[model samples]
Target: MPLLTNREIAETLERYANLASITGENAFRSRAFQRAADVVRDLHEPVIALMDRGDLRRLPGIGSGIADAIETLVRTGALPPLDALQRTVPATLLDLLQVPGVGVKTATRVYRELGVVDLPGLLAAAESGRIRALPGLGPKTEANILAAMEALRRRTGRFLLGTALPLARRIVADLQGTLPAGSSVAISGSVRRMEETVADIDLVVSTRVHEAIPATVAHLPLLSGIVRHENGSLRVTTHAGIPVDIVVVDPSVFGTALIRATGSADHLALLPEVLPSAPTEEEVYSRLDMEWIAPDLRLGLGEVMQAKAGTLPTLLSVGDVRGEFHAHTLWSDGTATILDMVRSAAERGYAFLGVSDHSRALGVANGLDAARLAAQRQEIEKAQRATGLRVFASCEVEVHRDGLLDFDDHILEALDLVIASTHSGLRQPRDVLTERLLRVIANPHVDIIAHPSGRLVERREGGDFDWNRVFAAAAATRTALEINASPERLDLNHDLARRALEAGCLLTINCDAHSTVGFDALEYGVAVARKAGADPDRIVNCWPIERIEAWLQTRQT
Candidate 1:
């Protein structure tokens, strides 16, 4: 049996939930499985180990039934109920759910009503005008579905960074345990660069015993099958359906092989035609008379010339960030209490933590009204006194369609920080959306714009706003634009973030955490800032607490 990572376990549970949804089983049961998947995925400890210790049921949302299903999966590598459900539906029907706007309900309707079992079938149905005549779906929905299909087609082979990185790390850890002691195994390609989406995973191995690799890979539980093996390089397919390329090289040319595998073609093109054989990347760059470039900067951009000129800007790192200004507690939909959040922040060496629960406009999240917001502050004060960690009382207030904030100025002014975000109207016209953002940026009480694009990577496209105007207004108002660190929403992506800095706008990288484990996502946000060449001085949260407090005071006045 293969060793299942937490992500794989979560994915297995999610598959059951989706299958249940398609089978029209009890909706509550499906949701319970989905929530269990969420908790398992975010767990710091291994789910299997918890099961081994008979502590799986202690996890929130893990009841006896779900716990038993997990045990079956761990023990036999199969869930009988899931296996039975899979036989009832066309396997291809689940492919329709990958399209952005196609939910399980929509997929079920199309599968039952239109016989649309896959992306191509869904596209054909939408194009033929067959879907418009359906009971609830109109012409607009059909058109949107077609658009989503087109978008999905453009990036069919890519997986989000969040999904691919963890899998890659798990593979690396597994190999470290199983491989020869002196072997060097490291991730390369876009996964190392931390690209928002990766086409494939790459591993560069430095080992003298090349013959041992193929035999060892055969035993790696993470892989489903070997794709190709030749010339000391192996390609394998993960159980998650991702392709991984493993290039084994002599320890003598390991640096050369890594350079060949890691860099973009254009980035390599600008370098010397002949390369030197070295064991370290620093030596490889030194042989070429260039500075050691960070992996994220190897995007074939101007970094090559900058490296030669010795003028690469000092990029912001995860450690440079002292704290975060956008996070949540149980005051909203968050899973942890204020005290738990503060203790987690303290563990991470954060100087201060912001408790920005959702505002009343976001009713689905159980957003806090004015009274609830005030009551939450009392808890925040208690947490601060308990932990000696400065807890900033704040709210992630919503921006209405008409550009008004969810809370009045008087209420917002009383908070230590105010993060304005748009929960709806993301599809508004360009002029209207840009205007809405401008209003939020111009608000004296508004300190930051969270997840400025409202985009979910590879799922939904972002709003089409006039960014130049938005950046200019933000520069004038000193409103920091957030690079939300959530795996699904790394908004103010590197390109936009760099442009925002060019327009003199301040930048902030926040986790937008909903739980204690949520802070772990801060690294993704820092990746965005580093890719944009942002400095710690420009990120307000990276400043000392006194300096951050002074800056917040300036915005209020």
Candidate 2:
């Protein structure tokens, strides 16, 4: 059986859960699968290893049934329950669920009552005013469906960076063993550049035996089938349906070939037509009298010019990050307890960790009320004393639609860190959204604005804000804007991060972790900062604990 990553397994389980819901299966059963999917997705270890140890059900939400289903999926690459449902439910209904507002209930309603089976049919019905006339749905719901479908259409063919990167790394790791001693292998193209979404995976391999490369990859368990094989390149499909492109080149011109393959078409246009052969990318850049550009910054957006001018900013790296501030614990929806979370941070050699659970307004996340928040502080104090890690008390306070914060001013002042974020009403008009964020930024006690855009990659669009006004307000207040490192929501993405830096705003790169393994996403956040040409000095969380504490103290006063 081909190896399945945790994400792939989680996605399979989630699909089964969604299918069950659409088919009117038992609600508790479907939720069990869904919750199990969430647990598996956040896990740092491979699910197969746990299964090998007969401990798959040891996970929080996994029961005997879900464990069996996972084992069946890992072994056979199919879920019997999901297959059964596909026979009864129109598979197109699954596509309908992909729309933002169309949940299982809504999807079932439309398919059974309105006879709407897919996006096109739904769009047609909405345009014809048939959907609003349904028993429960209104004109507002129809408009929302139309808008969501339009947004969904724009996101086709792209896979999240979170999904594509790990798979590429896995493939590259497997292929690395096949290479001769001195040969090289690496991920390239957009995946290397750490783009938010990717159309396909690209790899560069340097070897003496080009033909053997294809023979080796052909046997990779991850590959479903080889799409095409040529003299210098090969294409294959994974079981999860992502495309892979591999380029093999002679060792002599490996660097040249890699630079060519790792291009943004526009970035390549700026280079000399005929490139010199070199053994390393650094040498290639040296021959061209330019600095070796980090892959994330090779977007052809003045980077080449900056390279020539010797003016490229020193970019932040994963190692430069000292700690994470926007993390959750058992006080909220997170699985890990405060002690476990602090221990994980300490194990990572972090000088400090912040326990920023969700505030009262986000009840779905088990957001902490003032009393709960105060109680959690006792736990934080206990964890800090036990772990010898400086644990900061904090809250990811909600920014209401009307511009009020979830916590009162006095409550906010008592915390070591306060992160204000918008958890709902992201679709408000441009002025309203901008004003809402601006108000939060201007608040005296709010230290940082987390996930400024409130977007999930390929899932939903973010708020339409007057960024100029927002950035200006944040800069004026010395408020930090977060580069939320969750692969699903790399909010304040590279482009916006650059603009915020240009506007003199302080930035923070946080994992916004919900579990211990969640801290692994810090690399993605650092990549965002690097892509924005941000220096380590500009990121608040990159500071030493003493400096960070001083800054927090300043904010409080």
Candidate 3:
């Protein structure tokens, strides 16, 4: 696509920064442009407007070169130098630099020596041992490069919550060891809100630990490789192949830093309206004066107004969750047995655990038929009686390709909880998908809608349900929306969760765990819900045991 306007200029500059970072070019020049682009993106007034007013030069980090570039973009709608560079360096060559280990020198060498540009060409060269033949490139290095590239592809141009969460946890743990006494640390941003895919991982540490950040970050077991370390921030790649960035700041500024880093960018842009004159992030939240709002709740949809008016819905936190709602067992694609699942929940101090094995429609998952489901329920009841843990017999009943529940009403009525979900036919027209979902919501036996959107982060496309209709139906039917916590499927993403709440729909954060290991995945779902601005009161699982039982009973009636 042809680059046009200030936005395009900003994007082109970003490209320049990425290329510069990869190629080992003049680092300061690249950083200057990147920072300038960030400033432009964050500007409330249009870049063109700032240029027309001759005020572009006044913005920090926007030097004479960037000022001239902005003016050219505003006037001629193009950057001649950037265009000329694109011609000199094949666009394909630039793409090669996107590979994790590919440097500018390597990219230049590949283009000059092997005439290889782009991923496919590079892959072929690596396979043919041509990449290993390059000076300073060994066979093992070439293999590692190829492996990294493949991992990158699977990552789908985004960070997976599954990988990022553990690394963040480790970093937080390490910070505890290095920080001054009474220091606090947390993982914030989309990871905190439980989005399945993350662009970056953000950590906020409150410490006199600022001075020790470098050593703490340097020693992290996850830091198999360090990409860059500047100031108090460090970016590293974990042994598990996920990239993470850690920022260390003082305790007083922790809230502001958390808010700043835990941003959707779009959400942060709307903040000035909430606090017209507050320049710093701390001031932005302090204007309304509540222990700064959590990053996941910064969705910009009037959270600030609610905070100002003292009507902000109390968002759900990790502690509010009382049970595992959408879990599986050996009966249907889960690694644990019903008894094992119940025992694990009890060990975690949960008041209840919902055993929601897959229903028969998900044949590939070895879902349970009525006979098996009945047996599983009996087993769960036996386990509950023996272990003293309340085990709710639930089923993740699939909404078939034809949009009907996997189990008939008779079977659904027998369950303690039924979480209806769509496992196929995601590409149906919006209206059809909406109607299909409405039917499931209206089914008196279905108590919750699991992973309503059916997105698998960057791997699978999301469904086409008309959210307005879906949320309305959920509200009317009193069906809770499940925030599936699996890293690959943090479906019912933050925005949808917010809309669900606005429409008076209840939300539940579920691990959708297939194994005991998967039970920890609730963090991701909670992160998405937090980002959606969900409060503890709106999340049914956060309720006390009696309250949860009452709610479930109400759904049954």
Candidate 4:
């Protein structure tokens, strides 16, 4: 047996907290458990080690109650509270919690009244007009739930990109070492494209004999079980439960094999042509008199035509980003101090850093009020003076459903930048959400709109809105849209990002970092930008500080 990763343990606690919330537990107690998960995630050491040393109680935010819960999970692989709640709340209601707008109260109402047991059941109820009859719910909410469940179905059983990428790379590296010197191995499929969710890791090995694959793969250390082995491919599950597929081919046709293997299937169908024995992917494209496409852009979404016409835009790279506009510090909910985050950005060779903590409208994020915002600005300027790095004070002002920002004009006008975001009252009608966002974008003080879609990757569905209208409003108002780089919320995902580009909206790739290490998420953002055919010319963060500062001066009311 292996010790559970810190993230795994924290996630288990988080689910327990959610379950507790639905099972009629005290609100404060449930929040405490949720905070404990955050504490464990932030701690650098292996939490299991702390338990073994009997020091779990000493960990910050770990009270005796949480400590006991942690110990039970580590020792027995289950939480007693969660187990008890499952019996009381029924597995069906717990499953319902996975839907975005369907909260515990709503779930409870539906469960008691309609006995909604699963997504299909919920979908049927909503479609048949049964859900609208529940207390506090109406036709609009039923539609929202119906859409959310549809989105959830598409992502069911998929692994997050961040988790799957590293594991896939490690497996490829290990497999490379096991093969003969002449052979080469590469990872393809969704891992290569950086899709938010992946079904399985795809591996392609260019080696002489197809029969050579299974023997070495069979003896690998991590292999827990084999799913299948036939026709030059093998399917297996790792001990960690990640699914993997291996495609073996001869080295002579390595390039074509890789291109075919790294496809969306639909993307490959649009390829001008495919040929064997192309030494490299570039050559395959060159053979058809087309420009090479980024692996991330192989989405069957007109890249082929763009290449043929020589109109393919150069995509944004991690190297192009120069600053961040959405970051948090201890003044808000961030784990890092302002100066620490600034120093990290400076060390990364960034030209500037924007310390944009959350505004008071979002109290759950430890958002700052006007006074705290002013105090934070002073601290940021002090750091700028000492570190010789440009640190701009900014705020992520909330866009209220009533079409107002969290801060007044007087407060917002004082900041170097304002990133308006949607946080509270997200479950509004499509027209209402669009109008609220349009209002934020139109604010002369707001330079950017962070996480425009308000989607949490695979976890939550994007709020229903008229994005075309939002994009048109952002363009008209000169409000740049943000590509939030956080792994959990890579908002402005590839598809919508491309659409934003077409709508002529300028974009910014920001880390929305909460800690020093969060800057690393910039790479993921760049990956998304590239996938969407975005370029430095349209990404404001790619500009030098002088340019960005000059642009900021123009946004003031």
Top of the candidates by TM-score = 2
Q: What TM-score goes with each of the models?
A: 0.84, 0.85, 0.63, 0.78
Residue 454 error for model 2, in Å?
0.8
Cα lDDT of model 2 by residue, 305-368, tens digit = 9888888877778889888888999899999999999999988878888899999899899999
Ten-residue stretch with the least lDDT total in model 3:
272-281
Top model number, lDDT: 1
Candidate 2 versus truth, CA RMSD in Å, comes to: 4.9
lDDT of 1 by residue, 1-557 (tens): 76566667888898889878876876798999999999987775566668878899999999999999998887888877778877877667678888888888888788878887778888899999999999899887787787678778776557888888998999999898888878979999988888888888999988889999988887786775577999889998676667899999988888888988887777889888888989988899988889999888898889988988899888888899999999988889999999999999999999899999999999999999999999988899999999998899999999999999999999999999999999777778899999999988989999999999988888878899999999999999999999998878999999999999999999998999999999999989999998888988889889999988888999998
Off by over 4 Å in 3: 1-156, 175-196, 203-216, 229-233, 246-290, 305-311, 535-537, 544-557
Local lDDT at 469 for model 3: 86
Question: Backbone clashes per model, in order?
Answer: 0, 0, 13, 0
- Stretches of candidate 2 above 4 Å error? 1-92, 113-115, 124-144
What CA RMSD would candidate 4 show?
A: 6.0
Residue 404, model 1: lDDT of 98
- The TM-score of predicted model 3 comes to 0.63
lDDT, model 3, position 118: 80
lDDT per residue, candidate 3, 1-557, as tens digits?
32233345567777776555544455787788789878865553356556667788889898999788767765776666566556656566677866766766677677777888688999999999998898877676687567657756765567787876776787677666766676777787777755566777777666774676666666654454457887877786554445677776776666667666677676678565333233245565766564355555666667766776668667667777888778889998999888888888877778888999888889999999999998887898998998998888999999976668888888888898888989877767788888888888888899988888987776555776788888888999889998888887877887788789999999888888887778787777777777776778889888898888888888776
